[model samples]
Target: MEKQFTLRKNEDFKRVYKKSKHYYNRDFTVLVKNNGVNRPRIGFSISKKVGKAHQRNKLKRRLRSIVYNNYRYINNVDIIIIPKKHTTDFTYDKLKSSLGHVLNKAFKEKKINYVK
Candidate 1:
């Protein structure tokens, strides 16, 4: 994703984690908050338990690509994605499906609308 659509600051992450609710699944944990911006912002977190630096970086790249490609379905929210240890066990398609499912669930629960 572009820098403009990315959640970069520590304070931004803390605010979302502290104030918003999250969706948890076997692959990932998604923390979401309405940012009131025209576009959504996203951040990714991969713990050491998941992998080393190279593996973590690769996972982040994959996630960024997935989110960027599906940006149309994302609304004006701040989404923080924390991958679980077993995330890498899945293929890219599986990961993408899980992420999409989680996001769709959150959007429905929060009554947020996104462009199809």
Candidate 2:
């Protein structure tokens, strides 16, 4: 992903939270919205309620990996993945599954095309 396309500030998160389309699954939340920009972007928020610093970092790593792995093939949407408390103990497979599953559900609900 391009550096400039990333969502990085408190205000950006607030905007997405307020204005974006959101979807949720048992273990993940996927928020997406068209910002009318030409590029796709991403950000992550793993809360302290999920665990201590180590667990939070782990969750971020999981999300970053999943996003990077799939970023190239996705459409130009701004994505923010918020990991809930249940996400802390997730394995790689679980994380991938949760992300993919929830994102697909979200896409379906919004009628967004996701090329496999």
Using lDDT as the measure, the top candidate is 1
Task: List model 2 lDDT by residue over 25-64, tens digit each.
Answer: 8888889987777777888877779999988887787778
Clashing pairs in 2: none
Badly placed stretches (over 4 Å) of model 1 are 110-116
lDDT of the candidates, in the order given: 0.83, 0.78
- TM-score, one value per model: 0.90, 0.86
Off by over 4 Å in 2: 109-116
Clashes of 2: 0
